[model samples]
Target: MFELNDLRQTRFYQDVFAEGKQKGRQEGKLETIPQLLALGLSIQQIAQALGLDEQLVKQAAQPKS
Candidate 1:
């Protein structure tokens, strides 16, 4: 009695996926931030390590001051 029709929640799926992606991005930042800081990597190096754009890395690396 397993029917695929029971899984008709498109919005729910989207929300779940979005949340997962957001959490993953946060965790990745948490994991990479220290490496970047420890190595004293430039924005470009940090971006390369994370396979992200240098601008994105720079934005992420901005000090909290």
Candidate 2:
């Protein structure tokens, strides 16, 4: 029987887990932009610190439409 534990042991599962982890980390960084801005950090500074593109930082700072 292919149990949850068995599924978790597969290469595909591992790859997906890694991808999700990276995405989560990226989202966490994006989420922090507001706080950083409130702390008086410029968009350029945030982009450099987070290793993100300046355009991405600018997009994150904008209010969601």
Candidate 3:
């Protein structure tokens, strides 16, 4: 029983860590949109290169408050 509980906890933490890593990668991609645009890439091109939606790329290109 103790071993099973430990294994569940470990799996839960591993899943959380994986999700965090994915989120970090997505944020990093969003951060790069401006630079890619500056380099003369269109919204569609940036989205294709980043494997993201064109709307997401356009949203990221918007100025922050």
Candidate 4:
């Protein structure tokens, strides 16, 4: 039988895994921002099309250091 501490650790790991998946999905969407921009979509338009924040889209459009 699982102890309480074991159950808590399992839940913590599950939460972390779920968060990683979500971040990966967001990164994938961010990676698409430039392609959408190349297609002539404005930041606002891209955000609306992708259901992302306009600011986040703009940041993604910027060249990375």
Candidate 1 C-alpha lDDT tens digits along 26-56? 6787468656777877777777767777776
Per-residue lDDT over 1-65 for candidate 2, one digit per residue giving the tens place of the 0 to 100 score:
88999999999999999999999999999999999999999999999999999999999999888
User: Tens-digit lDDT track for model 4 on 1-65?
Assistant: 87877875797878987999999999999999989889998999999988899899988999999
After superposition of all CA atoms, the RMSD between model 3 and the true structure is: 3.2
TM per prediction: 0.54, 0.87, 0.84, 0.79
Query: What would you estimate as the lDDT of candidate 3?
Result: 0.93
Name the runs in model 1 displaced over 4 angstroms: 1-5, 8-19
The per-model lDDT (C-alpha) reads: 0.71, 0.97, 0.93, 0.90
Candidate 4's C-alpha runs over 4 A off are 1-9
Alpha carbon lDDT of residue 26, candidate 4?
94
Count of residue pairs whose backbone atoms collide, per candidate: 0, 0, 0, 0
Model 2 lDDT, full chain set? 0.97
* Best candidate according to lDDT: 2
Error of 1 at 2 (Å): 11
List runs of model 2 lying over 4 Å from the truth: none
lDDT of 2 at 28: 98
| lDDT of each residue in 1-65, candidate 3, tens digit only | 56865865797878987999999999999999999999999999999999999999999999999
lDDT assessment of candidate 1: 0.71
